[model samples]
Structures are given as structure tokens and as C-alpha cells.
Target: MERKGESRGKTPRAPVTERDSSRSPKRASGLSREVVVSATAVKTANPLAEEFDLSASKSHGQEPLPVSFSSPPLLDGLRESVLQALGQSASPTPIQALSLKHLFSDIPEWRQYLLASETGSGKSIAYLLPMFHHLKKSELALPEPTSSTISSRSQRAVNPRALVLAPTHELSRQLSSFAKALLHNIKLRVLCASRANVKSTPRATFTASKMAAQFTDDADGTLGMPHLGVSRPVDVLVGTPNKLLEMARGRRWDRVKDETDKQLAAELSGSRSETSSKSPEPEMGLQNVEWVIVDEADILFDPDFQESTRTLLADVAAARGQPVPYTPDLLRSSPETSTTSTLTQNTPINYPFNLILTTATIPPSLATYLDVHHPTLTRLASPKLHRLPSTMKTEYEGWTGGNKDADIERRIRKVWAEDSIRSDFNGKRSKILIFCNKGTKVQSLGAFLEGKGIPNVALTKDSGARNFGNNHHLDGFLRTTNYKPKPKSSSLSEDKEPHVMITTSMLSRGLDFSPDVRHVFIADEPRNMVDFLHRAGRSARAGQAGKVVVFGKLKGRGSAKATEMKKKVGALRK
Candidate 1:
């Protein structure tokens, strides 16, 4: 096991070369020729840059067509029902405003979109509005279920037409919640893949026979049910890659220990595809997926998830016996003959799924992968994609005082002791978020702070951790903040809040923090420019004032990274 600061030997990599904007990206590693739209830097006088205007610019001389945000049409492309559900939070973020046209349009040329924007820029809504719009259109266009043709289509168990893959369990849940809110009254069921089971709050009405046909009680007597039934089809499935695959292949709900349960599982699984009179139908997951979206693209490209990620993509492509465009030998050479044989054999090239990949930071590796896998990915980026918002102020606190871990802690202590932070707090419990490089450091630093009488909590993954467990300590820590108790829970004044929260980079990407967060501290130096930006982004969200202090030397590796950080921040500060 590698320690917090330990390093695995770096793999030798090819030398890097600078490319010009006029030239297309290199087609390396099985990359084929396809439409490529690279990111272009644009500036505007307004804080939120104007939406992309493709109307030939009013004869190229009429002042470039001023863009405005007005009311009668608060947002375009969304139906009135969706707009009503959004309520007061209906205004489009910068990312949403630019992408909505392509999202809902049926144009043949505008199917795939790649979003690279900052955290909290509303990337979820960008893809979701289009997805829901498509689903709604499909729902409306289908003939009434009274018709035998329509009934057959509806009765064929719930094969999700829209699938969303997230990197972490938390991110998957967060994305699913947003989707459910937007889907408010739409006759669609959202499914989340959990360990050994699928979760869905049955929004669509289903007959008892149909429900019983699709599920069976496990050994624990709890129903291990599939997300969809004959009466209702799942419109959206949001889950991590592994769990999503398990549901797609019909293995997550298998309860062979119970004879009745075994038969029910087989019946539900075989309903997707019928082979012969004697042979049962095969369970082809994702056979009907029309839209497959991968969120947090950079994390999915990590070494740990690379192989499973590739296999999942291959399976989706081959779900309907379609010819995969770029099937690598790694996918075909697997020792598991059953899986490999099914994935490689092709009947015809039927590409039913369009891919949408989004991330706050696009590393070079990810950019290269896009060049190969999603050659036609239409790149749309926020003007502030790589920069901090104007409301966020950054302070560079170098390790000038000392060079050891103790020195880092002392620097942090000094910053919290500053009168300016106190002034910002004004005798209220300080809403501060501290970030560390690894999980172990998060726990250690959190315990250290608690030992120093600064009440705190650690939110890292469970290891030897203790505070996150059920106890009075967490309650006391919550009292220090403005956390309100849920309805019908124990009644208390609810004024207490923790002085500080120490956590790992897991919270850096897409999770929303409380609006009261006024300050952020980085206890350990981040590995990349993207890490730094996301860490600082946790605060100053929803148009609030926030400050971030970094405790590290702005030299050596930090020097180049800091320079890039400054350049990006300066661009948005304009």
C-alpha cells in the first residue's frame, strides 16, 4: 500500500509538442478521421459571456449582435412543465445558455456535444434538458398503449434509453437527484444502481402482475427487483460504471438461492431478447440506449477505471450486435472467452448511442482519448472554463516559515488566527473547508485540529476513521454551524457549526457545499492545476464571497502551475 506522500515510478512518456489552433489534433492510437471542434478562447465585456451566435452576424457589420438575458423566454428549448419545476432556480447558467440549441435541435449535424466547464457551471442541466426533451418527445410520439404494437414496445422490460455514468457513488447520487427533480411530472422512472440491487421510487403506475413478474425476494426476504417492469420502462439510469454494467447484464438482481426467485430473475432477464422456442432469451443490457453520457471524464480516464471503462463502452456498442468502430485487441483478448466472444462478433454496424462527455478539467490524456474515441465531439466551453469567478479572492501562503509537515500546520494556524478571517466570521462559527492530498492526511489533520480544541470533522472514506460514525461528536460539530435539523427530528436551537471540515479531493469536483462556506484552506499541495481550481471552487458558489489560502512553495513544480493558475484567473477577472 502506498502512503500519502509515496510515489509510484512514473511510466516513460513520449515528448510533448505544441500544436497550432489552425491544425487538427493528431490521429494516434486507432483514431479515425472525424469532425473535430477544439476549444477557442473568446472574451467579452460582460462577466457571463454571450451565447454562441451562429446567424452570420447580421451582415458582419451590425455591431456583432448584442446578446441579452431577458424574461418572456427565461430559457429556450425547455417545455413549460420543466420550466415550472425549475421554479426560482430556472435561470440558465453560462454553460446551459450556449448548449441548449444543440441539445434539443433535431439537426443531423448537431448530435454529439462535449462540455468543458468549471464546477458549479450547471453541466448537469445542459445534458439533462436535452435528454428529458428527447424522452418527452419519444413518450408523446409513441402511439397509445392500447395498440398491440405500442403495448409490445412498452411491455418489453425497462431498457433505459438514456444512461448516465458517473465516477463516484456520491456523484452518481447527486446526478440522479437533479434528474428526478427535472423529470417532476414527466411519466418517466429514474433508476440508480446500488450494490446487489437497483433503486427507484416507482413514479409510474404498474400492475401487480407486471411488478411480480420482474422481481423476487432474496434470501433476506427483501425484493431484489429490476428497475423497470412490463407496465413501465425506465427512462433514465444513473449509476457508477461497475454497477451500471451489472444491471445492464441482469446479474445484480440474481437470487438463485431461492427457487422461485431464480425463475423470476431468469424470466425478467430473458424478456429483452428471444432466441428460439427451446432457448431462453438473452439479457442484453443497454440494447436500446439512445444517449450515453459519461460525467467527470478525467476521472474515468484514471488507471484504475481504464479497463472496465473500455469494456463497458464496448459492451454498449455491441449490445445490439452492432459492429464496434474501434474495438481494440485488449477487449478481444480477455481470458474470459464467453464475454470476449460476445463483444467482438458483429452482425452489422448499428450505432444507436450518441456520447456526451463533460469535465471541469480536460487533462492532456483525456484530450487525446477524445481525439480517438469521440472524434466528432462538438466542444463547447464556458468563457470562464479554466478560471476562478470574480467573487473568489486567492491568497498564496508559501511554506516560507518551515519546510516540514509541522511547518505546514503552523502556517495554517497562523492564517486562521488572522483578524481578517475573524472579521469575516464576526463571532459566528467559521464555515471553513480544508482540503488534503490523501484520505489519511484528512483524518490525521482533522484529529489534530480537534485535539487543539478546534472542533472539526473529517469526511474522507472510512478507514480507521471514527468521527463520521454515529455519535455525539458529530452532533456537537454540527451545532457549531448553521445546519438545520430535518423535519420531525430532535428539536434543538441548531445554531452550532464545525470550526473546520477536513476532507480529501473527493469533494473537489461536482458536490455542492453549503452556501455559508466563506473560506477554504489547502493543507497539502494539489497535484495539478485542475485540482487547485476545483478546491478553490467549493466556496464562493451561488454568487457568494469566499477566500482560498494555499500553503505551499510557489516554486519548482508549484511555480509553473501557479503561473497557469494566475493566467486563468486573470482572464475571468476581466
Candidate 2:
């Protein structure tokens, strides 16, 4: 039989490695003896560096994850249910198998939870499995409905009890679709922040394609609102942070009435004063929200977002004591608002919900902060099939000079010799994703790679019309523009599954790259704990094996500084 590590195909590559510096530090060569030594020392059965490329990852604080791991409660059953729903052909990959459990287990006293796993580890499924269970298994209730007594779509909500937040639009769209598929038989009304414009607004833009729409519709008109939707609440709900914030801040969400969204649209078209002046300010409606999930959690931990989240939580806590967080249009949308103006006159929201967060890689700093703020929060880690094993090759070439761009390119070319390329030129198709620290560096590298005949795509920050190309900050890109949208495209889903996706640190964690992405070339070094988490998590996921190669300054002034940072993180973890 062909060796497990044998090459599967061919992929064009840009020049690799960084520029030559004075001290091209001695890296842990992933050769025979080294592989043996590391394996002997390895604490767990995860793939070793001999098979995975992890020269720069030796210093990470992670404990290798085992193949068989257990989850908390209710989480395991939830995962099993989703797995069954997907069918046998759509089997759970190894990483998914490992991660699904821990992500779901409950922390009874804690108000928060966090997951740290790399891409291709079935991170999405981790949260989805449990959230679905929370909705279906939990006995919840929505607020009430208005307008036509015949009932509306959202009014069917057992009480539209939960809210989920995502960072990017593309991610939001991807997740909404995933939720729909998983809950095909259940009732789940998803209101995305990027919803269809009432007139033409990004905030109003909803992303329910035909099939997705089926899932968004509820048995009652309250499917999308607090009262009807909340009263008859659906099993689940998803939205973006900012958009949800705007909705919560605005008034109007009393109950689901006939033509509810339509009425709100007209009201939104008017001045804010006119909208809020007619109704009470919209606040948190968490009574029915038994489970609240935050996706792309690393991004949410940003100072700006964290502050906003605190405010959001405060709102959810107050919905019971305050009036319905509804707008005038919501009142007009629901004829009942005229009669039931207060919580005393209508259904009151009073209940606690579980909070769950998921991310491919989490920053230790942020994790520390969260722990400090929410003392009882719990953290879980997922396993990786792509480990830094010694059997895999590990080599480094350095460059030094005042002409930064030229030196870096030269170093990259030196490392991209014909030997490092895929063995089969025509049969093997490889995609590479380059990680860069600065936008300027990303631009330079992308331009150079394309110039050198490599079919590559660059994801960068938008510089006010200065530079652009499939760039997505936190609000995710549109799935239509991306090359890889569907997870199960048979064209390239098997062993040779790597696609080159160049990005900043944004694409680091919580992503899944099935069997194809065997080689991980890191142009940037993981400077801190969270950064390290993302880099190390990339290689092996879903039980399929893989490798990762990191190239950057690991010596001299810059490298020394990076070293110090690593040591500090190490001490903290201890």
C-alpha cells in the first residue's frame, strides 16, 4: 500500500520562506531521530510533527488531545441526534467526533462558555448540536401575538427564545443555511442582522434563500417577533451582533401581529423619534431564550464588541421588569399593543438562558478577561489530526536586508524549489492559504505569487477604495464570491482537500478543512497564546491527518521578542 504520508497531487506554490537573517536559528528538524524523540515524549496520541509540519509550534501550551474524548451532559445526545440527521454518508469527521461533546456539556453555575479548536475540527457542529438540543429539548415559551387572531408565522414560536450572533455576513449566511439543514424537521425562525433591506439597508438585509426560507417561516405570525414569536417562540434564532443591538436598542418588539415586519419597515423608514416615540424602547427578551450562542467568538472578545455584549446582556436581563422592547410599528403591526401596553397587560419575560461561544482559536488574553468578568465560565478544547510530528519535513531559510520586499521574496523563492511541490503536475490540484501580519505584506506576497504563475486569492482589509479583493473584516464575505462555499463538494473532498486561502489571523480557528489541506505554510509566526492556538489547530482535523509549516523571524531582535512573548504565555497557562 502507498505510505500514509505519500503525496496525493500537485499545486502551484508561490516562493516560500522568509528572508535570510544573521541568525537563522536551528529549528527542530522533523527527521528520523527527531521524530522518534518527540513521539516518545509526546503526552497524547495526536498526530506528531514527524507527520505534521510544526517546527514553530513546539513551544505551544496545548496538551495533545486524545482520539476518544467525552463531553459534558445533554451535549453528547445533541451531537448524536445531529449526526443521525446528516445521514451515514455525511459522517462526522474525527475532529468533529472529538469536539462535539465538550462544546455541549453544561456549566450549571457559569453564565458563559468558550471553545478553542482549529479549522476543520467541526467547530460549527460543536455549537449547533447543543443549541439545537436546547431548543428542542427545553420546554420554553414565547411572549404573545397580535394583529390577526388567525395567527402569523412567528407567533408559532414556543417564544422565539434564543439569539445567536456572528461576525461576518458570509459566515452568518453559511451558518443560517447550516442551521436550516440540521433542523429541517423542527421549527426555527432565524433573523439575520444582514437581512433583506426594508428599503435598502445592510442592517435590514436578510439572507434566506429558497430552502433557507422554509426554515425561517414559523407556524404562527409571531415567528419573528418577541410576543407571538416569543410567545409561540420557534426552537431557535440567529443574528449578527450589531444588527441585534440595533433591534434591541430600538423599541417595537412587543408581539407578533399580522404584517408585523411590514409595519416595522414603514416605521423604520421614518425618523427614530417617530418610531421610538410611539413605543417603549426595545430591550433584551431572553425569558424564552434558553440558549444564546456567539459564533466567531474571538472577534466578539474585542473591546468594542465586549462592551456592546455587556449592554446586550443587561437588556435581556431587564425585559421582565420593563415594557416589551417593541417599536410603534410593532404595536401597529400588532393591534393588541393598543390594549396590552404593559407587562402587566401582556405576557412577562422571565427566565435564564445558557450562553455558549465557539471559535477556531481563542486569545489567551481574552479568555483571561472573560474568566475574570464571568468567573464561573468554562473552556473546552478540540483535537487535531494534523499534529506537529517529526516524520514530516521541517526546514527554514532566512533573509536579511534593508530592502524588505526584495529580501522576503528571495527567501520565499529559495524555499519553493521543485522538490517541495506536488509530485503529480496534472492530477493533483492544491490550494494554498497564506497568512500575513500586515496588509502591505499581504499585498506584496499576493502580487508576487500571482506574478510567479500561482493561482492565488488574497483576503485583505478594505482601504477606502485603495485596495480590495475578496477582503472581509469581521462581518464575513458573501458566500457567492468565495470559491469554497459548500462543505461537501465531491470534486475535491477526499484526501487531497487543501485550498489555498490567504488571510490575516481572521481565518485561523473554527474552520474545517476536511482531507485535502495536508500542508499548512505559515508566513507569519504565532506571537501569542491565542495566535499559537490558531496556528497549531490548522493541520489535522476530523480525524484526517495533516501538517503545518511556519516561516518567519524566529531569531534576532524580532524573533527574540516573539520568544519572550511565548514564555510569558507559557507561564500564564501553568
Candidate 3:
């Protein structure tokens, strides 16, 4: 019998390989090559080399180009943007190369991909580059808007061609920034909609009325053009789920029409008109969206966010006139039946948009969820998915029964002292990241470290604590040693002391810290291997040498749990 979560006709996960010769470029001697202008001379240059037919070259006698195993063949515009964003000498990581190969293929089979790679492995660029390339191509194929239609188009409802959803506002903003960077040469417009963009307000008091008003009064005094400004139909939208959901559902303009009709009726009858009790219809902007990316898929699919994510998917499907795969109610009642029945009834569902789910780690729950819900998603995972980087060293400190705060303080000092001795320390303070399981612990530990004269910043899910954009201390700490912040009388100098950032797993998934963060301190035992991997992956990123110090207790069952965790970590390395 098959597994409970496994579907009957699911495609087996396979390693990414070049597609058929008709779609993919022919590889000579099992290597991909691209022609570029070169002045270097070749001693035995064969004008008629079998491996690389130089006769195809426009030039009469150009040398055989070296095979590029790192950089995959991409569109000219995308290639330039990639090199520009990641430096000319930099090349695509393993995940990036494989993903690009699959995405760049001309196979028109309604592709859905789940790109799982190790953290800091350029997953953002891997998806962003191809999405941009495809969108740009589509835009070019369309006829230019006439002068008469330009203004009308700008005032029309916001309809983005591509949408990227992130779990947190921070990650969403970061993804938007990266997307903007990739589009530096391209003309596509990238917009980020998150709570961060909205003015900070109490969640309970911020109702739909306030949101509608805010969106109305903000940009040119228009209704739909307020929040995002519909300046030009957004090309690519990056936002958190809640924010994107609101945008996708859109606002009700029928209220104005109802008010006008009621006034006219009152004038004609010389009496008040009964209010229309009909539900206001929503104008959807996601109808034209061709690409939908859910970054950090594991977190979004968790129970905490699963409902909203499912609703968003259903809304997108509805907008595109496709059958709803699974409603929230159906999933709650019977997920296996709802998903299987919806998908199996239709042998192949041609979704209007391509769905791409990117994550650093895929836990069993997420795996089961994907297999049951989206069995057709093609997975492109890296070889180093669950493993800790080889450059990262792990150290465990056990506390039998003592002041945990004091123990943490001592370890912080020890790490600082050790960092001071490094050859590249150069009298500059190093950065440390501390992960805690709870927000209360994060705050208390931050206060304790401050009392101990250790400069630190606390980041939590609380809106007040998460305003890192305005936190100069966090800005200074995350900046490089050469970074110079504007002078402030009350600001603590970042260079004078070692900076430690105390945060929950909120910063663990896709956020990138500075290279100065050489040490990661886990104040509490991670709940699982995925948590541990993400926490440790924050450091030792991009081939940087780093260390991880995990603190645990030795009393009662703590010792056994700690040992088991260590073994799991070791197994991941293998």
C-alpha cells in the first residue's frame, strides 16, 4: 500500500538534468558554452573543432570559448543583470544553476516548482532572474499602450503580472529590494506592500474603514490608486500574505453607486430610501497575475498561516477562472479528500499562473502537505539542503542547574574574546546573533546583556520591537565595520564594543546579516532540526567561516535530548 500522504500518480522527485535537445541547448562534451568577445590567442585553435564548432562564430578566427560550468546560459538581458547584481566573477550556486536550467527551458507544460536549497545559496536570484526574464519577454510581445490609453491604464485597477509572497514583512521587503536590484537594467516596476509600508497603528483599531480611507487619500485622492497608487499597473508585487490578500480581494466601489442611487430615489419619492443589504462585490487585481511565488514555503504552509495562504491560492484560482483546488473549510474538514478529489478529477489542471515555492528546508509536515495538495510540483533541491555548512563549527555548553542568564553572559564574553584574537579582527568589533525560543526570553536576555555592559539589540514579532528599519542600533550592528552612521548624541558607537543581536526565529528564514556575524548563539534548544539548521545557517554563509554555540541543560532528561540533538546535527553533516 502507498503512504497515507502520498498520492496515487505523483511524479517521482528526480535530480535536475538538461531537458530534450529540441528545447535545451545542445551540450558539447557534456559542457555548456556561450560565445563572448575575447582577445586571448589559442596555440592550437581549430577553426573546425568538433567539440565547439568555431565556424558558427561571427568572427573568422576566434579562439574556442571556455566552457562555463558555473554560469548557465541565460537571456542577454538576464545575464548582464545577474553579473551586475552578483559581481562579474561570481557564479550561480548549485541550486541556482539547476533551477535556471529548468526555468529557462522552453517546455510549455504549466510548470510548478518547489525550489529547496540551503540558506544563503542565492535562491532569491535563482527565481527572480527567470521570473523577470519571462515577464520582460511577455511585456515586449504586447503592443505599446497608445497615448489615449496611457492615462486610462494608469487609473485602472492595480493588476500585477507577477506576485511574490513572503512570510514576514522584513523578508518581503528584502525580497523586494533584491528584485529591484535585478531590474536595475530592466524597465519593470517592482512594488512592495507590507505592514512596514503602512503607518504603525494598533491592530485592533485599524479596521477596513481606516484601510480603505488610507488607500483612498494617500495617492492622488483616488480609491484603488491609494495604497499602491496604481501609478502604472504594477509589474511585480512583493508583499506578506495578509497585505497581498487585501490587495487581491480589492475594495468596494459599489458604495458610491449605492449612495447616488439612494439619493436619487429619495428625491423622486420625497422619502428616505432603504439601504441595500446586498454584500459589496470586490474588484480583484490578481486576475492577470501570471506568476505567483511563495517564498519560505514551509513557514507559510504551517498551521499558523495555512488558512490565509490557502485562501489566497483559492482567490487567485478564482480570479483566473480555474476551479478552486481546496477551500479553507474543505481543508479543515477533510484535506486529503478535498485535495485529491479536486486534482484527480481533472487529469491536468492548466493553472493560469506558475506557482513557485521556495524554502531553505522542507520538514516532513511540509513535505506531506505538498505531496497531498500539490503532487505535480517539480522539486529542485540542493545537495546541501539539510546539512550544516562545513565551515561552521559547533560547540555545546551544558548547564546542569544554574543561572541561565549568567551562563549566557559568560559565553557571550568568551565568544567576544575569541573573536578579538582572530587575524582579521583588526581592532574592529565582531557581531553575534543569539536565538531564543520565546519573546519574553529575548527581552530579558537583552536587558541582562545590557546590564552586563554588552551592547545588544532585541528583535521580536511585536510591531514595536520589529521596527528594525528605524532602529539605528540594529542598523549599526548589521552594518559592516567600515560603515559610518550619522552622528547622534545618544547613539552608542558600534565600533567600541561587540554587538549581539537577540532575536527569535523571526530573523532565521531568509534575512541576510552582515559578514561580521561570525558567531551564532542558540540560547535555547531548537524545537527541531529545521530550526537548528536555519539558525546555524545564518552564519558560515557564502563560504564564510563561523561558529555555533548551542546551550542546553544537563539535568533530568536534558542531557539525553541534547545528545540526541547533537547526533541529528552530525547526521545532517554526513
* Cα lDDT listed for each candidate: 0.53, 0.43, 0.62
Q: Stretches of candidate 3 above 4 Å error?
A: 1-73, 147-157, 197-230, 250-284, 329-350, 463-474, 477-498, 555-557
Candidate order, TM-score descending = 3, 1, 2
- Model 2, residue 475: C-alpha shift (Å): 17
Q: State in Å the error of residue 329, model 1.
A: 8.2
- Which candidate has the highest TM-score of all? 3
On residues 78-192, what C-alpha lDDT tens digit does candidate 3 reach at each position? 6776666555656456566556556776666567887777776767876887788888887889898897655443332456788888887766655665666566676787777
Q: What TM-score does candidate 1 get on C-alpha atoms?
A: 0.66
Indicate whether candidate 1 or candidate 3 has the larger lDDT: 3
Residue-level lDDT of model 1, residues 1-574, one tens digit each, is: 0010011222111111122122122213333322222223334322222211111011111111102222222223344444544343345554565555345556553256677666666677667767777777767797765666444444334466878888765555555655665554655666654333223221344443354357432222122444443334567777778766654544432232354555666688875323212211222246677787888877776555656565677788787566465444432232223254443432222344777777776654555555444555566655455567667888776566443446545654564566346765564444678899888887777677666656567877554332221212223222111224344435432232355678788767665565556678887767766677778887776455678887656777557656654554454455
Instruction: Please report, as a residue range, the 10-residue window in candidate 3 with the lowest summed lDDT.
Output: 1-10
Candidates arranged by lDDT, highest first? 3, 1, 2
Model 1 misplacement above 4 A: 1-90, 108-110, 146-158, 194-231, 250-284, 302-304, 326-350, 400-427, 462-496, 554-574
Clashing pairs in 3: none
RMSD of each: 11.8, 15.0, 13.1
lDDT (tens digit, per residue) of candidate 2 on 466-519: 121112322112222123444656674423332344566655644433344455
TM-score of each: 0.66, 0.55, 0.74
